[model samples]
Target: MNQPSSEGAAAETQSGALFLMAMLALGTVAPTVFWGLPVIVGQIAQQWGFGAAELGIAVLGEVFGMAAGTLLMATVLARRPLRITLAATIALTAAANFATPFAHSLALFIAVRAVAGIGAGALSGIAMSCLSYTKAAERNIGWLVLLQVLWSMALLGYVLPVVGATAQATGTYVCIGVLALVFLPAIALFKRAEAFVSAEADNSARVDVRGVMLLLGCIFALYFGVGVLWTFLEQIGMRAGLSEARVATTLVYANLASLAACVVMPRLGHGNGLRRWAIINIGACVASAAALTLPQTPDRFAIAAIVFIVAWTGAATLIFATMPRVDTVGRYATLSPGVLSLGFGIGSAAGGELIELLDARAAVGLACVFCCVSLLCYVSLGRAREAEQDALARASQS
Candidate 1:
């Protein structure tokens, strides 16, 4: 038998480690621009003379585009060089954002946002694929989540408000466009080794297609619940009689709580125990969604917001972390964002209709139902994994 040399193994590990860090940084920055839209939707509405219905339509367009882009990248573009594909996607995103400020009509605005979403979704898929190459996936994913939340807080709490006040909605779009351009230089880090990692992933155990499908379904349902509340979180606060400033402050606090959850996730590690944590988080999310139906008070609203953020963030982190471990080839991991984006698009559109027909509280109640369905999916996923393990063990004994 020919033994692999120690030096060769060390070099491979170093290269993989470098790719992991670079991917984390890219993931942290790219999505922040698109994710900041919800934070500044109020300013956009005022500037463009739109309302909740229009905003919901815009969000739906963007997330649907994201789903399409991620599907394309993971399937058709999967064999292409990672560096070139990522660079082109980022450049396209920058161009789309740059054109956003010139969109005078709602139709044009939605088109521009959809284009940007395509690029952002592809970026997210590539980043998740790269992270799946690392050995300690759960820990690194926790770090990725932490960095993303921190950046989101900065953009939402400080940057968007200042720019919106001065330049209104156009200024916010301009800032995001410029920020996208800044990431163009980071494309060089994608390197040839990434292709090698993707190739190695191809040789791993045969994909559990049924199991993977179930997991993706769960992810879709989970984010759908999140989107139902998130698409109108600010409006919800305002409806509760809170001032704009107070609502913004509440959002900042909620993100801070999410940040704290990310910080604690790595310490928990990965195991069967994660299922228990996920269940607990889902339960908390259901309670928070229920609380949104109650009468309006700043204190009650803030408490509910914090609880929702912490639980949702923690649950999402666990899901992302578990994907690479279960699939090992990164294909399912790459497609996770697509599933999530589709869910967001559907949830936002449906939530808007619910809010219009009934009330904000009614939309939240529907969200709680989605969360319960997601919980059932999680249980099914656990059973499937256990059965697979038992089958493999018996085969080995034979």
Candidate 2:
């Protein structure tokens, strides 16, 4: 990813607003298709004659692209104007995804997904950067959540049909491509001045590798569990005698809870909000693990789904919300998305492999352990802050 530069205009223009909205709209489409993959894997695999290993490889292609794009945006584009980067990525993803349904062979399809993955990765990074650049870092945080809500809404609308109608996957892919096209024009509209904020020339803050590692650890732990649960949740539910309709309803309920939380978290105060949200995320993970242990009846399933949603949404908000805060530490704000992408990649890889080994209940327990580690790290972080504050006060008194 590129770093923020001092050369760009100080304020955003109407063009930037349109650009942001476009990216947010397109962003949801890809992920909806992504999250819905597990529900459709059997159909896709059967159609494409894919073995488990082959299928996993295809998924990894996409994950690798995402990680690559995220790293590029964070390190390379962090210093550049975001509009250009955003437009290019959206265009690339849209084109690649549009070509996906027409692939004649599994290899062809995987190749298309690989390219699309890179595009999707860049799209996520650039979209996030644009959102952060819109105004003061503080205000952009709410805008960021709002962007997520919009994407989630789009995901909900697109995913339901894809899961329900076997015929919807091709059309869904094409539609996402079209959605990405819309961002091109919006990118043109964002004011040049508002596109890149200048940094202080004399500042020499060093990067906090430990902080970055900790934050990424948090994301990895959370998403890894989610990846495992999502890949097998429906399969497990069905094997346990759940009706397709009931299973679908459970997914809907979980996402709806997540949607509501995404909207609410950003509207709250800042300061310690990230810390509180981080703690909530750990709690959510524990709840989700507990949910998996419950009996597999409709009511129990519904409760479990709720726990999963709480955990999913809580961590997502905490991770993204804390992103800009890294700017205070060093060049991390520019590099954060890439580090995050790397974490997501690791999680996706590990999660996929883990789900293949453990039952859903056991998988959840393992995930909870990871979340507990994250909670301990965060709690210790808070204590360190308190200790620093006490020392500062004493020094001032002297």
lDDT of each: 0.75, 0.60
**Ten consecutive residues with minimal summed lDDT in candidate 2?**
1-10
lDDT of 2 by residue, 1-398 (tens): 21333233333242355555564555444344454555445555655567877777777777777777776665666556656766778778888988987875778878888888778777665555545544343345444554555555555565545644755556667766876776677665555533333344214443445556666666666666665565567765775578989998888777677666766665553566667866776776767666666667877777776777666665666665565544432234433344444444455566556656765566556656766666666666556567767998999999
Q: Count the backbone clashes (under 3 Å) in each candidate.
A: 0, 21
TM-score for candidate 1, residues paired by index: 0.85
- For residue 224, model 1's alpha carbon misses the true position, in angstroms, by 1.3
Candidate 2: C-alpha lDDT: 0.60
User: Model 2, stretches more than 4 Å misplaced?
Assistant: 1-10, 13-23, 26-32, 39-47, 98-108, 133-171, 189-207, 236-246, 294-300, 329-358, 384-398
Query: Which candidate leads in lDDT?
Result: 1
Candidate 1, superposed: residue stretches over 4 Å from native: 1-21, 46-52, 196-204, 233-252, 291-303
By summed lDDT, the worst window of 10 consecutive residues in model 1 runs over: 1-10
RMSD of each: 4.1, 4.4
Question: Over all chains combined, what TM-score does candidate 2 have?
Answer: 0.78
